[model samples]
Target: MKNFVFSEAVVMAGLRWTIVLIFMLFGLAKFAEYEAAGVAKIAAHYPLFAWMYPLWGESGASNVIGTIELLTGAMIAVGAFSARASFVGGLMGIFTFCVTLSFALGAPAFWEAGYGAPFLGSTGQFLVKDAVLLAACFAIMVDGLRRHTAP
Candidate 1:
């Protein structure tokens, strides 16, 4: 047991679970009016999601996204059985944040405040932080792929 490197294992496991928790909590929150409304406001400015309102409406779309997030979190928590799940979840996270980050381009109000490139407002800063999570998700995906393909 002395040779086992328990500290590294603990840190890795903690990071994985942290990713899982983030998705799960936000996924669950998507059902709430406040959360769903907030998502709608930003999604409105995202051109990629423009078709969403006409098809399923904001609440419906949010619930669908919530289901995806909840499933992603549950799958991430599955350890070895999570190989494909984590990869897909990571891709999903990357997609979500890419759209979120685009707000810097799509929303002029973000720049009109004189906050400059960094986006000084709470909402602007909130989307900016997703870049860190996006990178972490990529790392999770790479690790999962390595484990899956290892001999």
Candidate 2:
């Protein structure tokens, strides 16, 4: 096996930073409620998340989820204890994507409940985006694991 070097580690850090930046920006937007109205609009398209609006309010849930996203993003970017951070972030990404997919799939049924037409298209787009993000997370996790185990 090729021995790991500092240069490889730096490259991994850069990759992690790129992923973190994207998530950070999106998370910050949600936290500031900058896209709340738009999010609320799109969210309406997916009736599956209707309960979220009622439970946390459009802005509230946005803020809470945003905060979590921001924290995780920061942790990944910093690369401090990178292995743990990568593992957590990777797991979170996978979990979030799965949950969102579940919601998206159920959206049609939710709409039949009188919520209106499902935004299956937008939901599909969201799934695609998350899948990409999940892939990035997995890559980071793998890089981190390799870095940690390297001599």
- In terms of lDDT, model 2 sits at 0.66
Question: What does the lDDT read for residue 46 in candidate 2?
Answer: 64
Model 1 Cα lDDT, one tens digit per residue, 1-151: 7787666447657777898899899999988888878888877557777677668888887888789788877767775366676666666666766766877675645643765665466666666777887786777777677767878
The alpha-carbon RMSD values of the candidates against the true structure, listed in the order shown, are: 3.1, 6.3
**lDDT (10s digit) by residue, model 2, range 1-151:** 4985667657766768888887788788986656776567656456555677888898986777677678768767654466766767756655655655565555434343434554335445555566677777777767666656778
lDDT of model 2, residue 14 = 72
Best by TM-score: 1
